[model samples]
Target chain A: MGIYLPIAEISVNVFVLLAMGAAVGFLSGMFGVGGGFLITPLLIFYNIPPAIAVATGANQVIASSVSGVLSHMKRGTLDFKLGGVLLAGGIIGSTGGIYVFAFLRRLGQLDLFISLLYVVLLGTVGGLMLVESVNALRATRSGAAPVLKKSGQHNWIHRLPLKMRFRASKLFVSVIPVLGLGAGIGFLSSIMGVGGGFIMVPALIYLLKVPTNVVIGTSLFQIIFTSAYTTLVHATTNQTVDVVLAFLLMAGGVAGAQYGAKAGQRLRGEQLRALLALLVLAVAIRLAIDLFVTPPNLYSLSAADLN
Target chain B: MRAPNAFATAVVLSLLAATAPAKAQVPLTEGIQIGLSTDNVSITAGFSGADLTIFGSLENPDPLVARQGRYDVIVVLEGPPKPVVVRRKDRVLGVWVNLDSETFENVPVSYSVATTRPLQDITEPNSYKQLSLGASNLYMQPADAGDSPATIEEFTAALRSRKAATGLYSENVGGVQFLSQNLFRATVRLAPNVPVGTHKARAFLFKSGVFIKESSAQLEIRKSGFEQSIFRVAHNYSFLYGIFAISLAMLTGWLGRVIFRKD
Candidate 1:
């Protein structure tokens, strides 16, 4: 069955949307990454208008991330102080990102820019994860322990002034780099229509040396806020948020995330990471191919009033 | 009875000529009149596409003017005008980028034309240009003044090709089939993406390479049902709609979690 989306002004199969949402949500729950990076590209490939896809994709991220955050809340793994600082930066970065989006859209370069941004982000993140997971998996199969990077080491970030203590993560670090990292991720995710969880989880672990348990939950906490802000900004400014499409996706996404979190517990960390790496790589490779290959038709039309 | 009717029409024509001086250019509809299959179209939530049929009838008051079924009728449907921006891409650094662009204001968002025969077969090129009566021939008003003629031509061609490619603009020769002696019908398919507003449906009567009579009708295409309400809310109360959208997302999330709790 299909329904018409008023904001997108297109009729689409509701089942297809639900399936996509479920698939993305499952992957996100298993890997602890927001699925906007997957959903936005898939929508674009399906010929949905890029603006509508991006805006509605952000809305879906909010739904899945909220569910993820709630589940983590009961476990007491989230660092609210750290998440608060990140959210403060995200709000500022998202505001700036919307203006940049408007400028690029006015120049008719938004599609090209969005595609290029995805190619770089997914390519780098996917490439790093693939190499690291492969090594970790091999070490595990050989009955060898993989040596993790030393945590809580005195890094350059500690030298900055205005140090603050994060009781949950048990770290005392300057807030400057933390805020800047959060802002940069927020800017990228908002413009790319993601939740910044992929970048946030890794950055928190490596850059801030936040505990692995704290990273996933705290990242999701910030994502819920950032994605929600991005959705509202796109809706008010661009009027591209398709509430009908968002709801349909969220319906399958939230349910899928619940089951996926359960399924993740059955797999080893190395195997799960390996699988997530493969999934992210697949999306990255697809986007790269689209950029490199010649399109069948070139000319396109846009209207001032359209999103 | 024929003599009395002709005399009365002449008297009425004289009176009209004295009262309406500006309408002297268009002759009184002495040849053809058009009636649409339906003038008002409501695009409900389930609307995918619709066919607009124009049924035109030709009448010859003067026996000497014997055109028979040779009269070619071309019906053109032009949607409401909106500003459209088109960007042309070029290969730069082995990647395609939008290097040049043009914006055309007051351009019909959708234009569809159907005719009894080929456009060239029915009228002179001069009249075709003067009337601007075909899908490809719609006049484009360039938003920028400094653009050269070459750029204007390029932009106009790009606009026509893009709109035609999307089925928003089209032309089909022999689309208007004559059912009988003086009756004809033309069907124009309005794609689902057709701009939602009043569309001008113009029917032109051409006989022996001369424009004889023309009549224009308005067909309204507007959103209805659930779709209408959503579209209105988004455009009218955008901020409120945004908040509502977020709230909806959160609600669905919470509900999904509650329903599917493993514990």
Candidate 2:
């Protein structure tokens, strides 16, 4: 079925959009991520204007993050204090990012900047995850115990001033790093339309030394609000959010997520990580190729006004 | 009846000549007029592209010239004018980037033409240019006239070709047909992505390859449906719309978790 997207001002196939959402949702559920990183680029590839794709992608992330946060809340693994601090920083960072986004759009350089950011970030993150997972897999195959980082070990981050205790995670960390991390993710969320979970999870685990059990939940908690804020800003300032398009994706995504979670339980931890790493690498590589390749049409037209 | 009609025409012609004796041998000048059934057209969400047929007539066409197929009509439907920027991408450090741009003011968003015959066969190119008729003949004014002429020409050609490729600017040969000696019908195309605004429908009359008269009418094209309403709300009440979008997302998320809980 065909449906018109009001904000995008384009007619797209309903089934194609639904299927795209389902596929991304399935991956997000299997890998325990918000799926925004994948959806925004996919929308661009599907011919949605990059501006609309980024804004609508942020809107879609809210549903998935809320769903993930609910499960964490039930398990009592969420760290509300940490999430709150991160949110404080996120709002500020997201505000700045929105201004930058608008400026680049007016300069007609937003598309290039977005693709470059995706390729660099996704490529590095995916590369690191793949190597780590593969090493763990080899250790298990060779009948050796996997090496683990001791939770008691102290890092330079712990030495920062003005430390605050997070009771739920059983840790005392500096407010500076926490706020800065939140701000960084918030910036990425608004500009790239991602939850920044792929980066946030690892940063929490390694840099902040946050407990593994509480990391995902806390990350998701902050992600929900950050993406919600991003969506609202993009809607009010740019008027680029296409609710019709976002709704269809959410419907398919939510259904696919449930089944994906069940399927994920059947896979080993290292194997699951390895698969997700490969998927991330694939997206990054595809975007990188587009940057280097020649486009069919070099000349394009737009309204004189940014709208 | 024919004899009396001819005599009355001669008497009127003589009276007209006596009043303005500069040219005494000429008959009444041919004039064209077109009419529309409605002043506005509302297109629903499912609107793709459609052919709009306009009915018109010649007021004083000579029967002998009409019989010989010398009277030709060219009808055009011109969309609302808007300022547009054309950008060109250049390869820089192995990445394509938008490097140069040109802006044009008051350029027609779309132009669709319907002619009784091919444009060249109906009249001289100079006449088309003088009348500023047809998509090619329509002048596009640059916002910065100080720019190099070569660069302006390049961008202008690019703009027209892009418009043509997108079906916004089109030409339909033989789309206009004479129903009777003085009556005619013209069909122009409206593209799927047609801009919503006031469109001008113009008819040009030609007698034996000479421009005679021109007439025009106005039509308001508007989008009307559920989608259009949403668009209006998003732009007019943006803050409320943003809140609504956020609320909808949250609702969907909460509902999905409850309905499809795996644990």
User: Which candidate tops TM-score?
Assistant: 2
Please compute DockQ, using alpha carbons, for every candidate against the native two-chain complex. Answer: 0.59, 0.70
Off by over 4 Å in 2: B1-27
TM-score of 2: 0.95
Candidate 1: residue A85 lDDT (0-100): 94
Fraction of the native A-B contacts that model 1 recovers: 0.75
Residue B199 miss distance in model 2 (angstroms):
1.9
Give the per-residue Cα lDDT of candidate 2 at B123. Answer: 91
Considering only chain B, report the TM-score of each candidate against the true chain B: 0.84, 0.91
Q: How many backbone clashes does candidate 1 have?
A: 0
lDDT accuracy of residue A215 in candidate 2? 95
Query: Model 1, range B146-240, lDDT digits (tens) per residue?
Result: 89999889878988998888889988788898786567889888888887999988888887778888888888888888888999999889899
Docking class of 2: medium
Q: How well does candidate 2 score on lDDT at residue B210?
A: 96
Error of 2 at B211 (Å): 2.5
Clashing pairs in 2: none
